[model samples]
Target: MSSLTKNLDAIRQNNKIGHFRYTIGVTLFGMQLINYFDRVNLSTAGPSMMSYFHMSSTEFGIVSSAFTWTYMIMQIPSGLILDKIGVKWVSRVSSALWAIPTFLTAFVSGLGPLILLRVLLGVVEAPNTPAGSKAAGYWFPLRERGLATALYDSGTKFANVIGVPVCAFLVLHYGWQSAFFFTAIMSVIFSLWYWIIYRNPRESSHLSKAELEYIEQGGAQEDAQPEPGVNLWFVLRQRKMWGLMLGNFAYNYATFMFLTWLPSFFVKTLNLDIQQSGFMTAIPWLFGFIAEIIVGGWFVDHLIKRGLDASKVRKTTIVIGLSMGIALVGAAYSPSVWIAVIWFTIALTGVCVSAAGFWAIPSIIAPTGLVGVVSSTMNVSGMIAAIITPIITGAAVDATGSFATAFILIGVVLVLGVFGILVLMGPIEQMHPERNDSNATISR
Candidate 1:
């Protein structure tokens, strides 16, 4: 048998969790938790911060966008670094670096300092998604990746659910600054935990021979360390890479709109108080967490068993989800507060449903050694949307005096995203031209 076949056979027979994989997943998940806390703390603190600084809605939007600008610029380079140095130390150091700025945000007395702090936070946090993608690529096989990616990605949604209410309470009780202080402390605690536990799969004491073989057999280069010869031009030239990049940008445009504005939307448009708005904003994310896990694992598995191509399966789900999200613009027009909330919830559910598949696409299309760089490139587009969406939404609110125009705009953009997925995202396989041949061989 070939090396790949031998590895596949070994993996199929091995059912045990190697201590190393478990530790890595746990550490990565914790980092993801901190990542979300640091990012979303700003959203939770928006109301109080706006009042304290006497800032305009546009200014608040700029503060939120600052992180994305830095993050977008840094993603590709950060991915390259992760590929070179591996995930362990990069993740540990980046976690602490971002956490420090988060802690310092508690001391910001004005918009200037707040924006500066957010930019610094973005610089440090840029490596997170790339690192997580690298970890998933190295540790898991094809079949389990969706579930594994969801488990890691779920940390962000979990933070939305848990962090919002907690931060709201802190803002209400102590003040907005206290909320930052609390999240900073949590980041510090998790960073220490990550450093002590994480290890590369090859170096991990817990991984079994069978599991290692399985990963290698599944076309993963876990044992084949990243070499220096990989070039950016090669990755940038691929049609598949562009497809993922554009698709991610569209998805994030919609996702960040909700992340940054949902709480504020509740407060201003729905006439809800801070605590009530926070809780209400969190409900959709709670549903999102459930959907991401279920769709990433069970739903995808069902498609695979039905003999669908992985790319087709992912694209189909995302297209449907984005189409569903387009209704949010209509939701924006609702007269009743409860009706608006329901529409927003449905829209967000569509965004989250497509998320896991988005991350998985990079792994599917990336060259064996360039997974980190490719994933980061794809995520950079999303981060750019993060920067721009807030500014646009803020502008729309300021110009229109109501969030209705902004919601309509966001809905229209989501529809455009569905088009991008169907047209720009051509196929899901890594080697798109050869996918037909692979399928034919499989049939034999």
Candidate 2:
């Protein structure tokens, strides 16, 4: 047999599962769920938070923007840190640290302190996504990474689906503070549990030889170890990297604006009561969760089966999803609340469809072992947009006394995002020239 066939056999032999890998994936997914719940609880509690603090629309915007601002700034450094120290300690520490501020938000009395707490929360939580991406990159093989990333990313939407209703209930019965406190405690508990349970795959004794072989044979070379030096300048100079980064930014500009402001829009503009608003706010995200799971897995598999190039399949999905997101602006202008909700749900479903495809690109295109850095870079751009869009939307609302202008602005950005994906991203296999044909087959 040829050397390539022999290598494939060895990899397959190693790709077997034991109990430990399953535990790690579960723990990581839980952490992601809590991470999202903490970020979004503020949205569910927006009305009460406004009432409790007597905050203006602009003040609330600033408060919400604090998390994204800090999270954005920390993204690259967090990725670098993960690369150097590995994910185990960093993930646990960041998770535990973020929970402190989440718990303390219950005690905040004024806008100033609440904003400060959010900033702290952002700082601590900055590492969560990068750490999870790094862990996935390290543990899973190419074929599995898309589903892994989707499962992890879906935690965000799932948390929104569940946490919105739960938080709304807590705020109505106990108080807004109770919502924060509950989520905070859950985060802390999970952080500790994760630390106790997780082990790096290299160090894991329970992994079956078959599983290890599968990953190795799947072109996931362990030799691509994290280097001590990473040149941000070099990373930035790559046009393809910039394409991914900017594409991510455009995608998030609309998403964060919707996530941060949608609840308030329902209450203030649509005249829904808080409970009704919360349920309505959750509809888009619930649909988005389902879309991500189905599209992220099924779409790629279908493209591969049809003999489409992996890069083209990925880019096509992104273009379709982003173009669909532009419809959200029309949702904003709808005369009826139900119509608006339907439009919003459809738009977000599009975003979710694209999201899984977009995330899979990095894993497929990135140089071996650079998935963490690349993923972090792309997410940092998205977080930066997340930081600014809320504040800008607030200013727009303040200026116009309506969310219509803000929604339109976000829609335009989403349209631009479509172009970014189509023009800038080029081909997904460019970064891994040696394994191009092999990856294409697996993708198929």
- Cα deviation of 255 in candidate 2 (Å)? 1.2
- Clashing pairs in model 1, backbone N/Cα/C closer than 3 A: 311-428
When summed lDDT is taken over every stretch of 10 residues in candidate 1, the lowest stretch is 435-444
TM-score of 1: 0.92
lDDT of 1 by residue, 1-444 (tens): 445445555556566534356456666677788898887789988988999999888999999899888889999999888877878888878977766888889988778888999899889999998888778878877766777777788788888899999999999889998888989899888877877777777776667876676665565546244444445665665655666777788788888888898899888887888889889888988988888879865688567645567778888888877777776786667788788878877877778778888877776776666777888988988998899999899888888888888877777777777777786667776643233342212222
Q: Quote each prediction's TM-score.
A: 0.92, 0.91
Best by lDDT: 1
Flag regions of model 1 displaced more than 4 Å.
Answer: 1-23, 223-230, 431-444
* lDDT of every predicted structure (CA atoms): 0.78, 0.77
The positional error of residue 307 in candidate 1, measured at the CA in angstroms, is: 3.3
280 Cα displacement, candidate 2 (Å): 0.8
